[model samples]
Target: MAEGKVDPVHQFTIEPLFGTDHLSLAGYNIAFTNSALWMAITAFVLIVFVGGGAKQALVPGRWQMAVESFTGFVDDLLRANIGASGRAYLPYVFSLFMFILFANMLGLLPLALVGLHPFTPTSHFTVTGVLAIISFSIVLIRGFTKHGFHFFSLFVPHGTPLAMIPIIFPIELISFMVRPFSLGLRLFVAMMAGHVLLEVLSGFVISGTNAGALTFGIAALPSFLLMVGICALELLVAGIQAYVFALLTCVYLNDAENLH
Candidate 1:
């Protein structure tokens, strides 16, 4: 039981927060879970961070500055990737960026130390897949709404030889279809991998100390040091993955907003 508690894969479990069994809804099991709890927590944190910063002040405070910094960062990312007119989508892009950033960062909290579960919603493909679908759906809707049937031109490049049309179109269409899966999988895999590594090292620390003082020196100390370094790297990765997801979303938006 003690060993099972420290299992690396255990971190990803989605236990129901309320009832013992999952609820049924049209053949789907929909239970409020730890994952859902963390998502709510993530949303609450984002709301506070953004809402707290929306104060009218003569001289901006640190909290306000931090909010503005993140806002500007997203704005700049959009501008750089999608150009001047891209500011129209700032609300959507900013919300997406901040939510993912906060979710990734919040999941790293050491809540388990205080007897609370800390689940990263983004560590699950379902959450990330939904996010990717939202972004992809926006691109699809905007593409059709703005460009009409010309939106299908997205699958075809600016120019190509007549003979190459058959092959190139199919390949490009296939690649385009894979975007949501790739985007979601990237975040899920990155977040899950880090947590699994941390859990494994933590297990080593526990088991080594329990084995003997000699084994503690051989396994526990080195694993603890590596865990520290890995934690720092994971922090960096959390932010990077968020940025990459947002950046790729912006790139996809460019295909819709600019068609180039």
Candidate 2:
């Protein structure tokens, strides 16, 4: 029983929720993963919010009010950045915001509940990289569609000297590509590092019992405090990351529309 009670930090072994052997799908085995579960939950919640809000009343209920607030906020953000032109992309932006917001928030829940899974998809570079690639593709396609081949002019700054074209163009192109990489990495690293720190501190608390009551108490205090601070920070980061993503999208759209 004592052995069974080993702290999770000490037993950091992760077992895949879905195994290839279980599915026997030859080269393609899709197992039900915890990350998949949370993503589904996020999608369901988003649908409910949007669907419920569409049937608005004079006196809205809690869910309706909540949805309204988010919609209003996103609408205002779009109006400010892209003016009336941004209206068409509101649904996509809102969905992006809500999905990421929920993903970050859900990740902060206790490990025993949401974080115990073998695969943290958000922490995985592949997941974030894919999301980044999708956003990049959207920007490129929209820009080209709206501005014709002139969209390539984005790689050349407005006042760039003719002689500097070789140097500046490559730099601008690299910078554009870096946008998605930085966006995805920022969120993934924050989520992964915060959780890992919490787990490490928790391990200290669990393992220090044999030391003295004072030792355990001292070890626990900072850990608890850090956890609380990080939780608050995570909440703020969730919104900020979502906003940054949307803002970048808008900027890319603006470039597409203006061919700048």
Candidate 3:
């Protein structure tokens, strides 16, 4: 039982807050689980951070500065990638970036400190998949609405020969269709792999100490040091993944709008 309990993959399990039994509403499973809890926490943090910083003053506080800096960063990203037309989607892009950023960062914090289940929603395919699907849906809708059947031209290269067009179209179509799954899988795999490594190292620290004090220190030191290094890398990954997701969304939007 102890061996089974020490599994690193156990950390990813979704347990219902209300207990083993789940609640169903209108054919939907509405049980509040650990994933749902973290999601709510992420949303609350976003609301507080943005709302508290909404007070525009000449000299801004730390929170206000953070909010403004993030806003400016997203603004610059959109301007550089999607140009003037991207300005309209600013709210959406910014929101998605911040949400993923917060979710990733919050996952790094010890759940014991926050009194919540230590779970990363972004590590799960469901959450990331939904985000990717939404972005893809927006692109499809915008593209079809704006350009109609001509939107299909996005899959064709501008100067392709008629003979090559037949070959390239299906390839491009498959690639385009794979976008959302690829996006979600990238984030999910990265987040899940990092967290599992951390959990495994943590387990080593505990099992090592069970033998003797000296062995505990010897085992724990390197493990702890490596965990710190990994944590730093995870922080970088968190930001990069969020930015990549947002940037890809912008690129898709540009494709929709400009057939690029």
Candidate 4:
């Protein structure tokens, strides 16, 4: 890092929106942070969707149609993977998708344009880790409740030899246990990498602008173009990642209930 260069990781810093960022009670720092603000914003957006769509217009206006279409998409997704039983979990699955989708897309928008910093909560491991943990917990509780001891069979190979059961069991168990970590890491890394790359390329343009017109024309121009392309790609990634996460949830739920 040099002077006039942007720190790619600076965006991920958790700063307090209000004056005092630090407030400790009983040895635990419970200060409100930027991450909390974004989460609140995410919640507010969801509230608007729920409230705004409450009308259930007969003909359906533009915003209403948009809301209904998104809901239908999530419904279709759940039904496709988990079948009719998935409807019961639609609220959880849809909320997860919308929150991530909004966070991801909102993170791409320039703060200057929207008067809001595009801080992505999903880019942080803690946020995504909690989501993974919840998904994992659901798998455990529902799997066991639905099928009892048979849920353990998820780790047992369908056609493995009796002698190899001892060897295969541990490997499968480890893989099953690591699902949450893998899920969280995948989303966090993807988001963080894209944002870092965007920052780095924008830094190049900034440095090029300061150098001279020649450098700005040659280096900054191409860098800016690439940044634009990457921004477009990130938009696609935001939706795809959200869908992937939700789909995986349904798949895991399917495994828990059906035990395949």
> If ranked by TM-score, best first, what sequence of candidates would result?
1, 4, 3, 2
Please give the distance, in angstroms, between residue 77's alpha carbon in candidate 1 and its true position after superposition: 0.6
Error (Å) of candidate 2 at residue 191 is 1.2
- TM-score winner: 1
Off by over 4 Å in 3: 1-5, 113-116, 213-218
Tell me the lDDT of model 2 at 148: 78
**For candidate 4, which ten residues in a row score worst on lDDT?**
109-118
Angstrom error of the Cα, residue 173, model 4: value is 0.9
Error at 109, model 1, angstroms: 0.7
Q: Which candidate has the top score in lDDT? A: 1
CA lDDT, every model vs. true structure: 0.90, 0.71, 0.89, 0.88
Q: List, residue by residue over 77-122, the lDDT tens digit for candidate 3.
A: 8888888888988999999999999999988887656565567899
lDDT of 2 by residue, 127-200 (tens): 66777777778788888888777887899999999999999999999998898898788767766776677666
Query: What tens-digit string does per-residue lDDT give for candidate 4 at 1-260?
Result: 34648888998999986865668799888678888888888789878976797677799888888888888999999899888999988999899889989888877778846566768999999999999889889989999999999888888879989999999999999999988998888899999999999989989998998888999999999999999999999999999999888888888888887888
Clashing pairs in 4: none
Task: Give the per-residue lDDT digits (tens) of candidate 1, residues 141-208.
Answer: 99999999998888788788888889999999999999999999999999999999999998989888
Model 2: lDDT of residue 81: 76
Candidate 1 lDDT score relative to the true structure: 0.90
TM-score, each model? 0.94, 0.85, 0.92, 0.94
Model 3 lDDT, residue 52, Cα: 91
